[model samples]
Target: MRTYQLYLIDDEFASHYFGKERMVYQLFKDYKEAVGEYKKILEKQIDFILKPIQEIKIHQFISQYLQKNKDFYTNNGLYYLEIGKRSTAKLEIHERCLMLKANGNYEAETIFFEVLRKTESSFIAIDLEHQRCGWLKPIKERKFV
Candidate 1:
């Protein structure tokens, strides 16, 4: 039987569901590797995951990030957060959120809202904000299969 893993990436929150523990490790390796893999998957499957979003919405999302963080932007609206800068990088906020999700360290709803609030508040506080940015919007509670 072909095995599939379900990975959830909501703003910052991310989770993976697998029938086997070993498989999860193989696919994700660790939180950092998993985030990198998720980015690759998102790029490769952009058409599919982004299908529900209108072109303008997609553009707006990418544009906002570009405007907010310039150096990280690459062509084609893809922004990469460098590894050494992960701690304070706005892009890595979502990665930290994902790490929290993977470890079950935070409540999904709370973490989602907190990340949003912090991002917005931090943006407002600084004359020029330089940090990783992403948020988790609330969703229906998920139960692992």
Candidate 2:
């Protein structure tokens, strides 16, 4: 038998669920109260009404987070080591589109990921196999009329 707990595997997943990656599983300082609530949720026993947690805009939090993570700010590039066959293509495409839109502001927006088999390659070996799969434009099929 195996057990599993809900854990966002990466920044992308966290970003999708919690509005931002930096918001991953933080304690509310009142450890007992927070854990109590969590346990209740798991046990389906939360009876007492609790105040709603206020929501902060993801953009605002992302700004603060990126400031702290200077490397992420400086890099300004998204990478995909592998395009999993079972992965959610729509989500990946959404992330890439966001990056592409921000290209004007950052000027280094690119989704650099490896193709099948090869760990890396020269610039000439572009992975056009899935160009239409997760980009702003259709893969290499621009009309020239």
Candidate 3:
């Protein structure tokens, strides 16, 4: 028999070393139940990922998910928050800045990046504005669209 479990992944510290492993939290057996709880939790904060797991390891699952959805967050070439201003960096942002989503409509002070190519600690990201690629720490800000 197979069982399902849900994990609460912290989006804030997702890119730092050991962040993903340490942030995986909560366990639920039902997907719908978990989603319902996640929705309620989202009302209070946007920096949490509620992911459902079957058999795969948490780290593996998150890595695959981020790889698959890399395009969604990179459509507008991604943006770095500078006092709430949408700024594009030719390379990578040096200072810790919030990654903007919803095409800059929404902004959260969380680490968010689209993974083009990945390693254990970082990934290559494309700056569509400059048509250049640079290394960035990968972070999964959301579990779903």
Taking all chains together, each candidate's TM-score versus the true structure is: 0.26, 0.17, 0.20
Question: Model 1, 1-60: lDDT tens per residue?
Answer: 111122232332222221222433343433324467676774554223211213343335
How does model 2 score by TM-score?
0.17
| CA displacement after TM-score superposition, residue 83 of candidate 1 (Å) | 6.6
**Candidate with more favorable, higher lDDT: 2 or 3:** 3
Query: Top TM-score: which candidate number?
Result: 1
Q: Looking at model 3, which ten-residue stretch has the lowest summed lDDT?
A: 1-10
Q: Which has the better TM-score: candidate 1, or candidate 3?
A: 1
Error of 3 at 66 (Å): 12
- The candidate 2 region of ten consecutive residues with least summed lDDT is 116-125
Quote the positional error of residue 62 for candidate 2 in Å: 1.1
Model 3 TM-score relative to the real fold: 0.20
Q: Write the per-residue lDDT of candidate 2 for residues 1-145, one digit (tens) a residue.
A: 1111111123223223332212322221122245656755632321121112112322343344344432233223322222233221110122111221221221222222211102111111111222221212212333598
Residues 85-111 of candidate 3: C-alpha lDDT, one tens digit per residue: 442221122221222222332222222
Q: How close to the true structure is residue 88 of candidate 2, measured as C-alpha lDDT? A: 14
In order, how many clashes per candidate? 6, 0, 0
Candidate 1 regions with alpha-carbon error over 4 angstroms = 1-51, 87-135, 139-145
